[model samples]
Target: MAELRLMKGNEAIAEAAIRCGCDGYFGYPITPQSEVLETLMARMPWDETGMVVLQAESELAAINMVYGGAGCGKKVMTSSSSPGISLKQEGITYIAGAELPCLVVNVVRGGPGLGTIQPAQSDYFQAVKGGGHGDYKLIVLAPASVQEMYDFVDLGFELAFKYRNPAMILSDGVIGQMMEKVQLGDYKPRLTNEEIIKRYGSWATTGKTADRKRNIITSLDLDAGSQEKFNIKLQNKYKEIQDKEVRFEKIACDDAEYLLVAYGSSSRVCQKAIDIARGKGIKVGLLRPITLFPYPSKAIQELLPQLKGILSVEMSAGQMVEDVRLAVNGKVNVEHFGRMGGVIPTPNEVVEALEEKFIKA
Candidate 1:
């Protein structure tokens, strides 16, 4: 039987990680997401499931710890807010270059610099466009609700291991702090050392056996030619993910004349806006991207013919609008509507923007 509970999104993430057989968690506390580490510490999964949960001195140290654990074929994760996430980028790039599997959760707060502790979707570009210095991408999942907060932890780990790349749950302060009902999934046991060796010994840094060669996990190749080859390999993997991993949800798109493209908390606001627009007979719909990295570009492109315009709604100053425009390719008018620095726009405000930008225009 599934366990049903009312919990905050950040707490759900922590509980889900333990239930999903996560091997370890290393993170430093940050606003809007501190509950993740707190919950983990409170539960002490280390005593129950033998999962290693540690709070590092800084976000930098935490991400590096995740990198070290992931190299050993263990399911590891870390969590942070915008500024803290910035500190993890270097380690994230290294983890990607090493082709190690791990999960990262960023409960976004307002930013540019320590801007605010409130919710915002300002980090879309950083999450999807590789914030770190490298030719790499993390499989980014944006969860809009507390239910999804629980669901994506398991899915994120699955995708991470499948691609041997990092997977991130890009959430925001609203979802992190808001309490909601969640139906927890069945518990999955952590894989044993022998199981890890059997499944990932080819690349993971498991101890060498006489029957096989030693495995190495690294992101360095001094040879230019070899480095280029590695880059090409990473590019190919990204392409494969783009083809196979795009996820999205469409609401009232079939008969809509205008579209709204959004994700995370903005998507929830857009949903309400959709209702408002429909009530006013505006025929507006929403397309919510679930996977931000392998974005639903193809889906957006296919919906272009039926739509007269698109409004890329966000909680940032129009970051994702660029991607929507790139996908639309000027087939129709596309505009952006947003409120920045932790201020969330109301449904009426989004509807007004849609009216001004698409309906009235």
Candidate 2:
């Protein structure tokens, strides 16, 4: 039986990493998400599950550590808030370019630069649209609840390894800090060297063996033509991911005339707004994208015929609204509603936005 426990989202992430057989965690302390590292330290996973948990001098060092561990075919991860995630962009780009498999968690706070420590979804663009400089994408998962915070750690690793790419948990400070009941699953053992070799030996930098040529891990190609080919390969991989991995949840969308699109903490708020709107006979529904990178674009497009309009509810200054618009393709009106700098908009406010944008308009 799964163990039921009251856990904060950040703590759930840490515990899930251990239980899911994560090989290593390297991170720096950042507000609203520091509990992730603190919980890992308190558990002493190195002693318990033989998972290597280390505190790095900075976020840069932490991400590079993940890059190094992932190059060795290990299930490594790191966690940070907005500013720290910014510091990690260069390394994240490198990890993507190298086609390394690892997980990154961004428990977002408000930011253009050190904006606020409170919960906000301002990092949606950074998380889904490649905050790093490069032609690359992270498999971004937005977890709305503590249970999902626990669940996506394992799922993130699975997806990361599936494509030999980096994955990110695009959470917010609210999800990171909120306490809720979580069903903790059983422990899974880390993959052994033989298993790693058997699975990833074709590309991973395991020790050179007589059966095959030495494996190389790098993100650089001096030849422009070769680099372009590599970029095309990456683009093809992203298209495959988009085709196969789009994940979302629709609530009361079947009969709705107005749609509200959201993810992470905002999705929960939207759910409440849905109920309130239905109470007022507004016929509002929510479309929550669980996979932000492989966004539910097709799903949104399919609902376009039924929806009078879409109000994108977020904790940012309207970042994800762009994707909603792109998916809608001017077929229907799409507007944005948000609260920034760590301010969370109430369900009432969202309903009001829905009324103003879709109902009254």
Candidate 3:
């Protein structure tokens, strides 16, 4: 039976990692998400499941460790807040270049450089648009609830290994610190070395054996032509992921004249605003994006015919609004309303923004 517990979103991430048989977690302590490392420390999963949990000296070190672990076909992950996530970008790009599978969690805080430790969706572009570099995409998953925070940890790794790409759980402070009753999955055992060799030996840096060719893991090639070909291969993989993995939720969209587009914590706020708007006959619906990279562009385009305009509610000044606008392609007016520096907009505020930007306009 699955265990039921009241767990903070960050804690749920840690607990779920252990339950899902994560091979290792390497990260530095940072606010809004520091609890992820802390929970792992207190639990000592090394004692329970032999999972390696290490707090590296810095965010840079932690991400490199993830790169090494991933090359070896291990299920490794790292967690951090916004600034810390920025520090990991170089290594992230390297891991992507090598096509190593790993998971990253960013429980975001306000930021432009060590900004407030308050919740914010400011990292949307960084998360979805490839924070590292090159033509690569992190299989980005946005969790709107504590339950999703728990569920996505496992799902993120699955997708990562499925495509041999890095994945990210783009969470924010509001969800990280919030407490909720969560039903956790049953425990899964860590894969043994033989199983790892059997499964990922095709690409992972297992060992050079006579019976099979050696596996070399890297993102570098001396010839520019070779590099271009590799880049094209990566692009093809990204297209496949985009086609097969777009996930989102639509609420009250039927017969709606306007839509609210948001993700992560902002999506939760919009859900409340939708009810209040519907009560007043505003006919506002919500399109909550679950996967940020495989963005629900088609989903938004499908609703363009019904939507009068879109009021994008976010915790940042405006990040995701660009994507929403691009999805609508001027078929409808798209407006943005948000608060920065950790300010979370109230449900009433969202309704008012909708009224001002779409309904009243």
Per-candidate alpha-carbon RMSD to the true structure: 0.8, 0.8, 0.9
Tens digits of per-residue lDDT for model 2, 1-361: 7799999999999999999999999999999999999999999988988999999999999999999999999999999999999999999999999999999999999877878899999888888889889889999999999999999999999999999999999999999999999999999999998999999998888899899999999999999999999999999999999999999999999998999999999999999999999999998889999999999999999998888889999998999999999999999999999999999999999999988876676
Query: Candidate 3, which ten residues in sequence have the lowest lDDT sum?
Result: 352-361
Record all residue pairs in model 2 with backbone atoms less than 3 Å apart, i.e. clashing: none
Better of 1 and 3 by lDDT: 1
> Which residue pairs of candidate 1 clash?
none
TM-scores, each model vs. reference: 0.99, 0.99, 0.98
lDDT of 1: 0.95
Query: What's the TM for model 1?
Result: 0.99
Error in Å for residue 240 of model 2: 0.3
lDDT for 197 (candidate 3): 91
CA lDDT of 254 in candidate 3?
92
Candidates by TM-score, descending order: 1, 2, 3
